[model samples]
Each structure stands twice: as structure tokens, then as C-alpha cells.
Target: MTYEVLARKWRPGNFQDLVGQEHVVRALVNALDSDRIHHAFLFTGTRGVGKTTIARILSKALNCEQGVSSKPCGTCSACTEIDEGRFLDLIEVDAASRTKVDDTRELLDNVQYAPSRGRYKVYLIDEVHMLSGHSFNALLKTLEEPPPHVKFLLATTDPQKLPVTVLSRCLQFSLKRLSREQISGQLKTILESEKIKSDAGSIDAIARAADGSMRDGLSLLDQAISFGAGELLVNDVTDMLGTIDPQGVDNMLDALQDQNADTLMAAVASLVQIGGDYSQIIDALLLRLHEIALAQTDKKLVSDSAGNMDKLLKFADEMPAADVQLYYQIALHGKRDLPLAPDPRTGLEMMALRLLTFQPVAESKPVTNQSVPKTEPAAVSNKQPASTSTSQQPAPAVTASAVTNTASEASPAAAIAPETSKNITQNITMDSPWTDIVNALQISPLVKQLCSNAAMQKDSTFDVSLVLDQSHGQLLNKDRELELKKAMESLWGKTIKLKIELGKPSNDTPAATKKKELDSKQHAAETAINKDENIQALQESFGATIKPGSVRSRV
Candidate 1:
């Protein structure tokens, strides 16, 4: 006896035998039972995802000798011949090979005739999209109005190429790709029945590599069994698939989180020994980072099926969320730049090291007894960075008098004078406490714009009067205003109604404040550099000019 491939050998004999396509199966089963089947049926999906198989099963169900019913008796001659690929009435055509007008016409020439043996004459055409325009034109009429005994079963990976005329005439059943768990469960069952000894980890690796195709999973399983000398092992499967081990990904992430350059490089060396695909390693690392980031918000959402939940939860607790987000972005950019490296290993190494450089400094939790100084604006800014620790101190209540004449006077405390209603831009006074609150609000970008650019006029009983530049009228909407209001409510711990008004803003919007802050820092740094004796001496002796825009404050 000749050996058969697992995909062909274990083909689904009926709807019950199929996996991960309950949706298509249920519709087909109902159609078959109700005897309300359409003349033309189309199956669409990717390769190895049961487009052809479902067509074949539906063909058998329609032609079963037991009668015209959904539940086909496999022992009957019609079912046996269909299974054996010798059913006379069941005409199977590979449209990829027979896509010309003549071929299509020739196939449909006999459509008007009745089925020879089975109750229905089933024309099972695979890769129907390969048919040319002329072929589709030729198929349109017969497919639309075929004999009562004739059923058209079309399958294709590319349905977009098919003519609208042909598509409109058919009932399309889309098949979905199988999940990793579904594929793995099927693999476990197959292995148990085949008497193949295997561990769950090896099966998992195979299922993942299958890329959501049951046939592909089975094919890989066959190759894995052969490679393992009839025994499925994780190490052998990993080598066969060239997939980096999950543990290696964790190790690299561990090294990155710890900022341990030596451990990171060491992990790379170990991967090099295994001849791992660096791109795949990068992808695995990206997956780990995503899981860690998700874990920070909801620990229960992190998956432990691969047995790494505890590690991820621990990393989430230890590594700053900011760092996790930064790592994810860098990893995405690194994949794009991976091919530019002299070698993948060196590229991966540089990316790993760059992650260490960008790791966020874990914020120190604020102490409860720490007093917020009322006099110093610098003190408030220092106490709160863009991202702070879990332990937060309630923001000090700000009074209107806290700001200097420059910050508020830039934007007058009084209602915008009628003269300022035009395009006149006023410079707000400095030292306003509003900018600090805006920065600390931690709202989304849209709401941030509304808050940042608006100045809060002192309102009674925790209410805020917001003034936005009239030019930004398009950005203001009821939804955005509500979201902005909610953010303020959360921050101040009081229900505050926002009174929105359009005028020339006399106060510094968050955008203006940020620009002012940057300009001030840049000027101070330049002045300091110019004042340095060493810099001046070097310039005097070497006739060197400080490079334009080179002096930037660390702030």
C-alpha cells in the first residue's frame, strides 16, 4: 500500500467531521434539509482553509443515494463513489486549468441534461476566479438558470476577480480560518488516535505555525512526526519550523527591562547558536511587549495558555507602562529597519540596546505628607511629570491671585474687550496655574486640545469658564465639550459645568505655554553655553562658531 499524506488521508467525510466552520455548515445543512438549495453556490476563502473540501462535502450531501437529504448515508453507492472520486454525475473541474471560453462552454453544454445516477448533477469547479471574462460570460446564463437536477458548486480563493453577474447568481458561503486552539485540539485528537506520542508544547508550536489552516496544521504535523522520528518533540518542532522559542523572547524582554546589556547580547548569542530567524524573534518580542502593556490595565486579559502569564504580570508590575509602550513602538520601527542592517543579528542587537537607552525611568511615588508649595510654580511642575507613579497627591487648589500680572494680564481677567474680538492676538500673563492643571489632566489628544488652548476664568463653586480662540471653532463640538467636562470633573473631584465662549484668547493656551516653555529653555541653554569660559576660549582660539541650534536644554 502506498503511503498517503495526512491532509488527504484525514479529509472530512461529512459536515460533522469538519472543524472551525460551523457558520457555513449550519446554513448548508439547513438548505439541504429544507430542499430549498439554490442552483449556484460559491465558496470563498484562503488556501488550505476548506473551500474545496466544503464544496465536495456539499456535493456528496446533494447526491447521496439514500435520498435528497442533508444527512447522507456514507455506505450508499453514490456516497462511496463520491468519496472514492468516481461519481459519474458529480463533475469536478479545476477552473484554473479550464478557464477559456471553450472550456467553460463545454462544461456547461450538458447542464440542461439530467444527472445520470445521483438525484443532482453537481459541477464542482475549484479556483473559479481563474476563469476569464469570456468564460464568466459563458457561465452566467446556465449558472443562473440550470436544470432542477443540476447544482453549481464554485470555490475560489479570489472572489474579487469574479464578474458581478456570476456572483449575483450564486449563494456565497464564506469559510473562516481556524483558530490556534481549534487546530491544536484537532491535532491532539489525531495524535491520540494515531498512537503518536506528543507533548502539548510541540503541538502548540505546530498549531501556531499552521497559520490558521487545519490542512496546513496537519501537513506540518506530518512533517514534524517524520522529523522527530515518529515522536513529536518541542525542540525538533521548533527547529523544523524555525520559530524562536517563547522562552528566548521572554529572556530578551527580561534583559531589556533590567537594562542589562550583557544579558541582552548573551541572549542574542544563544539565539544565533540556534540559527533563529531574527525577524521572527523581533515579532515574538513585540508580542511580549503588547501582552505586558495589556497586563498593566487588566491582568486577567493576559493569556497564560503558553504558560507565561505570571512572567508577564510580574513584568507589568515592575516595568513602567511608559517603557512598555515605548518598547512596542521601537519594536515596530525595528522590524521595518531590520533588512537595512549589515546582518539580522547585528540589527536585532542594536534594536535591543536602543530599547535599553529608551527605557522610562520608574517614577517615584509621591508621599502623602509632602506639602505642595503655593509660592513656587517650579515646585508644582517638578512634582508632576507627564507620567507619574501610581501614588498620586491631590492637586493643590489654585486661586486666581496665584498667577502673576504677566500670565493673566497677557489674557485679561476681565471679559475680552470688544476691541479684542477681531484678529488681535494678546500675550497672556505668565505664572498661571491653569497650564499645570492642563498638563496633569491626562486626557486624550482631542480633549487635550480643547483644554490646552482654553483659559479658565475663575468660576464660583468649582465651575470653569473656558475661552477658546475663535479660529478653533471647528474643533469644538458638543461631544468634545462633554468629554472635556468629564476630564475636569475627574481632576477637580467636583461636578463642574463648562461655559464655552469664542473670542480672542487673552490667556495662554496649552499650546502657547508649551511653545513658550521650550523657547525659554532653549534660550537659557544657548546663553549658558555662550557664557561658558571653555566654550568662549575654544571659539576665540579655534575661531569656532557654535553650530546653529545645537545648544538644547536637557529639559
Candidate 2:
């Protein structure tokens, strides 16, 4: 006898053998047990997900000589013939091949006739969505009102293509894709039954490669067994599938956490030399990062990481969650654009470099200067200072480098406060308070227009008082004053009292305001330098657009 492939060899013969479709099996079994079968049944799902298999089983249940039972006895003639694909009463048609109106009419023409061998004549049409418009119209009437002895079972991956008229006549059942664990378990069972030796890791690799399709998983297993000749191993499966090993991914992550670019590059080179996919490496790294993030939130979800869970959790604790999320996004985009790059290695390196370059800087060390007493330290005599005369004299002089280092270690904020106050004094002109308040209000368009022509009332206690013109003052109602106050406080980081007084218009008008704006713009442009670190980075790296009206704070 010819050797059968694993897929066909492990085909499910009954509902009990079907995996990962409990809902579908339960409904069909209940219908069969209760003798409440529908005339037309529609099974829809992607390929290798038991759509057609369920149809075959249902056909057997309907026509089995043991009666319409959920568990049809395979010893019965009807079940045996159906299983062997020679049942006279069950007609399995491929709508993809015969998708014409004439073909549909010819098939439906015999629908009115009684069953030739069993209680029901089942028509199992695979890929029914392939039927043309005219063919669908031709079968609609027959599907809606088939003879008592006839049943229709239509299966399609794309059910949306089927007309509503055809869909309304049938009872639809959608089969779900099997999960990874379910697929792995089923493969293990099949391999055991076939007496094939394989490790769990190899089975898992095949399951992931299959992507939730049982037949695909079995096909992958068949290839793995043949490749192994007898024993299946994880390394062999990885080599066959061109998948990177979990250990390599773990090592790459370790390199990243250590910020050891040399180690990262070496690991990547090894992966490339071994014919591993660079994009898959990035994808696996992203998966590991996600696992690490979850592990940080809950320890139970980190069970699948072998012995690396503790290390991953440690990395997670050290790194901020935002950094992990950003790297994950970068890795995902790298995977998407990997094929477009000149070489996969180049793409992978670019992604790794991007991640390393953006890692957030660590927080600054705390200032540790010992505070002197408010009253100042007590003075000692110069010639025979208390106890210093008997002690060995200090070194002749301190080096300039030592003095500079001591001063450099001092807190810059404390050292710079006096200098900052002097600069603030010089810049505070007679009209500085008014101008600053106006500029702060300019942050919002509405407030800017309302206070355009307002005049400033100079007072020592009140930072800057605004007297709005009649029309504009009316716009700055009580609610608007509160809004302006909030915006000013946010900008200044302190409260500046503003008393809004309605009065006659000042000489400063909107036309004068326009002229001042142009002068201010020119002054800003002349003072602006391209050496600003943020602007330079934006221009050189990302080519950011700097709009004219955008505000910049004085550093």
C-alpha cells in the first residue's frame, strides 16, 4: 500500500474526532439527536478548518442505516460507502469547477426525486461562493424548497460573496480556527498514534508555523518527520522553517539590556550566517519584549519563557514601560519594511540602532554637599590655629584641576540663581510686563484677539493691569478673564493679578499692533540660531517643519 500523508491519515471520521469546533459539533449533534435536521446547511471558514469535513460527517449522519443518530455506526452500509466516497445517495460537487447556470440546474433537477439508497439525498457543494450570479439564481428556488428526501450542504471560505437569497435558505455554521495549544496537542496525538518520535519543542514550532490550521500543522509535521527520518527535534524544525531559535532571541535581548552593541552585532551576524530571517528575529524580539512587559504587570502570564522569565522580569523592572513600547513599535515597522531594504541585515541593524539611540537618559545623581550652619563656621587664629601648629602642615598648594573639580561638583542651580536674576532685571523693560502678558495671552487665538488693543495700567503691586477697549472689553467677560488668568499662570508658573477695567480706547490701535508684530518677527529671526540642539536634531534627522507663528521659550 502507498504511504498516506499525515493530513489525510489523521482525517477526522466523526464529530468526536473533530478538534477546536465544540460549538459547531454540539449544534449539529444536538440537531441530529433530536431529529430536527434542516434542509439546507451552510458551513463557512478558511481552508483546512473542518468546513468540508463537517459537511461530510453531517451527510453520513443523515443517511446512515443505523438511523439519523449523532453517532452513526461506521459498520452500516451507508456510513461505509460514504466514508469510501462511493455512496449512491450522497453527491459531493465542487462548485469551483462547475460554476454555470446549466450545471446548477442539472444538479437541482434531481433534487425533487426520492433518495436512492438512504433516508436523505445529501448534496455537499464545496466552495459554493464560486457559483456565478446566474447559477446562484438557478439554485435559489431549489435550496429554499428542496424535496423531503434531499438536503443541501454548502461550504465556502468567503461567505460574503454568496447572495442574501441563497444565504437565507440555509442554516449557517462558522467553524473557528484552532488555537496554538489545541493544534499542538492534536499533532502530538497524531504523531504518537503513527509511532513518530518528536519533542514538544518541535511540535510547538510546527503548530506556530501552521497558524491555527490542523491540516497545515499535520503537513508540517509530515515534512519534519521525513526531514528527521525518524526523530523530530526543535533545531531541525527551526532549520526547516527558517525560524530563529528562542535562545538567540533571548541572547539578543540580553545584549540590548546591557547596551552592549558589540554583543548584539555578533549575535545578529551569527543569525545571518546560519541563514536565519532577520525580520523573524526582530519579530521574536518584539514578542519577548511584550512578554517582559506582561510579566512586569503579572507574574502568572510569564510562564512560557522557559527559564528566562526571571531575567525578563528583571529587565522589565529596570526599563520603563514607555521605552519598551517605543522599541516594540520600531521593531514592528522594521519588519514591515525589511523586504524593501537592500539587505535584511542592514534593516535589522538600523532597527537595533534606533532603539539604542532613543533609550531615555538615566536620572541625574543627587547633590551631596554638606550644608554649613546658618551662623557660619567659627574662625581660628592664623599663626597658631588651635590644634594645627603641632599637626603636619597641609600640602603647599592645591592644584588648579583640584579646585576646578570641586567647583564643578557643586549644584549648578544654586550657583546660577544670582546670575539669572541679573539677566531677568536687564530684560525687564518698562513695557516688558505688558508685552509678556500679551504674548502669554497670544497662546490662545481667542484671547489674543480680545486683548489686541488693551492698554496696560502700571502698578507696583499688580504685575500688569489691562484696560480693554469698549468692544473688546465686552468680549472679555467674567468667564474670559478666568480663562486668561489660567493661561497666564501656566506660562509664568506663578499667579499674576490682572484687573480688567472697561474704559475709553487707547491710542494703541489694531494697525499699530500689526506693525509691532512684524518688527517682533524680524527681531526673533535675527536672534534665532541654527545651533539650537532640538531644532538641529529635528532638521537633520526628521526634517521637521518649523512654522513661523509657533512660539519658542527662552532657554
Candidate 3:
């Protein structure tokens, strides 16, 4: 005799044999036991989830020779015929093939008649959603008021396609997909019963590959059994599914944690050489990273530690939370873009490089007592100098002392001096309030570059106009303006106004000119520090960089 496949051979013979669908089973069993059966029943779910099987079992239960009972004795001729799809009273129709209005009319015409040889005449219409609108309309009246001996069982994967009017006429039961553990347990029972030699690890691989479908798992198991001839092995199953071992995934992750590019790429190449699916490898990596993140926050959240939990925990400890989050984001994005790449290997490499580029570096130590060289200001006239032709041009006459005079005058004991001008640029001074405010903002290189070309104008209600040089006017961005305004308010203890206009500078005190000179130099220094590699290294190594407003000097 030809052998029956495991899926059909082990098909659930009774409701008790059904797995992961307790709610549907319980409702149907209770209805059968209490004689509270509905005329029409709808079973909805994905493929391989037992929707049609439940329909068949219900047909047997309703037509059993002993009468409609939940546990029909399989020994009875009526139950046997129903189970074998030979019962004269039971009709199984695939709506996909017979979806015409004429076919539906003919079927319903028979529904009006009483059962010939059983308690009830059952119509099990599978994929009922395929029926055309006209066909559905033709059967609506008969389905709503079918004869007492007729039962309608409709099954469909896509229930949303079914009309609401039709759905309202029947009792619907949605079947759920089985979980990995549930599938694994069921596979173990089947293998043991069949006396097939297999390992739990091999069964797990099949279960995961099945993705919550029992039929899929059994079909996969059948392939593995045939491939192995007599026994199923983990290695054989892994190769059959084109999936990498969990250990290979863990190894790849370890390489990532260590930032060992060579090792990671080698592991990927090894999987490719063995004909493993690169996409699945990436999926497994993502899942493992999630486990690592969980292990970081709570050790107990780590699942199936076995021997790899230690490595995962170590990775969690060594990496910062922000870095981990960044890695996860990069990996997800890479997965999305992987298909567009020429090859999976190249895609995986690009993803690894992205993570490496963003990893945080160790902080550096701070440099102290660094001094900047000072220059003497050339004499100036009341008229604008040639140097002032460009707004960003330096004022040869003004000195650093002139710019900081107000700040020093306001608080004599404030330690305000030329040496501390860098910090003073971050604050406003009482001396020449308007000029000093601009000088203080010059502490920021970006602001100084933009404002150097700005000549102070008369203050309006909310708008203080500055004569802007065309070249430098474009330098001011929204962020820089906001920062300047915030610093000015901190100095004045109230809101100061601002407006930009085109004009020339007013001949004021040489002190004001001197203040502008000092402000320019301080601003230049700040810009240099921002682009300085040495400063960045110091910041990363020792974490000792000055705050935005804090003073730093060359000693």
C-alpha cells in the first residue's frame, strides 16, 4: 500500500486531537453535547490551520449513526462513511470551482429536501469567499431558512471578502496558528509514535521553519525523513531548510561585539559556502540582538541561555545602551535595503560598516593653561578704515580691553579681565551694553563671523537694526540667531530687540572699536577649537572639554 503523508495520516480524528484551538473546539463540543447546534457554521483561518478538518469532523458528529453526538463512535457505518468522504447525506463542495449562480441554485435546491440516510444533510463549502455575488444572492434565502435536516459549514481563509449579510447568518469560529513550542511538542509525539530516530534539536529547526503551521511542519518533517531515509538529524534538517545553525548566528554576533570585521565576514562566507540563506542569517542576528538588549536591562529576560547567555551578557555590559539602540536601527534599515544590493554578502558587509562608524570612542583628558598669542591694534581715525570695508574685516584700532570694559566695570570683583575675555563673550557687560552684548556673542566663532559684518543700528521697540555687509549677512542661520538672542537676554536680564538692515557703522568711541577687535579674536579661537582634531581627541579620551559658555586659555 502507498504510504500516507504524516500531515494527513496524523490528521485530528476528534476535537480532542486538535491543538492550539481550544476555544473553537470547546464551543463546538459543547454545542454537540447540549443539542444546541446552529444551522450554519463558518470556520475562518490561514491555510494548514484545520478549518476544513473541523468542518469534516462536525459533519461526522451531526450524521453519526448513534445520533448527533460530540464523540461519534468511528465503528459505526455512518461515521466511517462521513470520515471517508463517502456519506451520501454529506456533500463537500469547493466553492472555488463551482461559483456560478446556476451551480449555487442547484445546490440550494437540494438543501430544501430532507436527509436520505443520515440525521442531517451537511453541505461543507470550502473557500466560500470565491463565490460570485450573484451566486451568493441565489443561496441567501435557502441558507437563512434551510430545512431542519440540513447543516451549512462554510470555510474561508479570507473572511473579509464575505458579505456582512452572509457573515451575520452564521456562527464564526477563527482558528489560530500554532506556536513554535506547540508545534515542537506535537512533532515529538508523532516521531516517537512512528518510531523514527530523531533529535529534539532537529525537531526544533523544523518547528521554527514551519512558522506556526502544523501541516507545514509535518511536510518539512516528511522531507527530512525522506532525505535521511531512516533517521532525521539536526545537520540534515538545517541543510534541507537552507537555514544556518543557531551557533553560527551567535558567532557572527560575537564578531560584531568585538568589532572583528574579518571574523564576522568569514562566518558569513562560511554560511554562504554551505548554501545557507543569508536573509535568514540576518533575521537570526536581529533576534539575537534583541535578546542581548533584554539581557542588559534584566538578566532573567534572556531566554534559552544554555551556553551562549554569558557571551550575550558580556556584549550587553561592554556596549552602551545608545550604541546598542543605534546598532539595532542600522541593522533594521540594512535589512530593508538588502534586497536592492547586488548580493547579500555585500549588503551584510555594508550593514556591519555602518555600525562600526557610529560606535562611541573613549573620552580624552583635558588640556590646561593653553595660551593664544595677542596682537597690537593699529591706530584708527573717526572715519571708517579700509579694513572695515568688509563687515567681517578686523578693526585695527580697537583693543580687547575696550570690548570687555563694561563687564569688568559692572562687577569689579568679578575677575573680569582681558585673559578671561573668552568667558566674557558668553555674558553681557554693563559698559556699552549694546556693544558688549555683541562682543560677548563673539565668543562663539560662528556668531562672531556672522556678526563681525553687522554694524550696530539704533534700537527699535522690538527690533534692533544692524547694518549688514552683503557678504556676511548670508552667514546667519536660524539656530545661530536663536543662540545669540538667548545669550543677550541672559546678559541684560530682559528681552533685547534685533533687526538686520543695510548701512555703515556710526563713528563711536575707540573703546567700542577695541571691544569689537577682542570679540573677533575670541570668536575665531572658538571656531578653531570646534574643527580641531586635538580638541576632539581630548574630549573623547578624558571627557574634559569646556562647556559652551566656560572659558579656556592657553597657558
Give the top-scoring candidate (TM-score). 1
How do all models score by TM-score? Answer: 0.63, 0.62, 0.60
Each model's C-alpha lDDT?
0.73, 0.70, 0.70
| Residue-by-residue lDDT tens digits, candidate 2, 387-427 | 77445234222233444443443333222122122223334
- List the candidate 3 regions with Cα displacement exceeding 4 Å: 291-324, 339-343, 355-555
How do the residues 1-555 of candidate 1 rate in per-residue lDDT, one tens digit apiece?
Answer: 886888888898899999888999999999989989998999998888898888888888888877777678888999989989999999999998986899889888988888887888899999999988888887888876677888889999899998888889999988888887788888988899889999766887888889889999999999998999999987788899998777777788877655455677777778767878888888878877887878877776764444355676888876666667767876776687788777787677666655654423322111111122443445665777757532333333342243332233223221122112132122322233666566555354556666667776765644667788787777788998888778667766777767887777787886676667658766865675555444444345434455333333534
Task: Give lDDT tens digits, candidate 3, residues 88-185.
Answer: 99888899999888998888888877888889999999999999999888767877777888899999999999999899999999999987777888
Q: Which stretches of candidate 2 lie over 4 Å from their true place?
A: 294-320, 336-342, 361-555
Which is the leading candidate under lDDT?
1
Q: Candidate 3: how many backbone clashes?
A: 22
Per-model root-mean-square deviation over C-alphas: 19.5, 23.0, 22.8
Task: Judge candidate 1 at residue 98 and give its lDDT.
Answer: 87
Q: After superposition, how far is residue 170 of candidate 3 from its true place, in Å?
A: 0.5
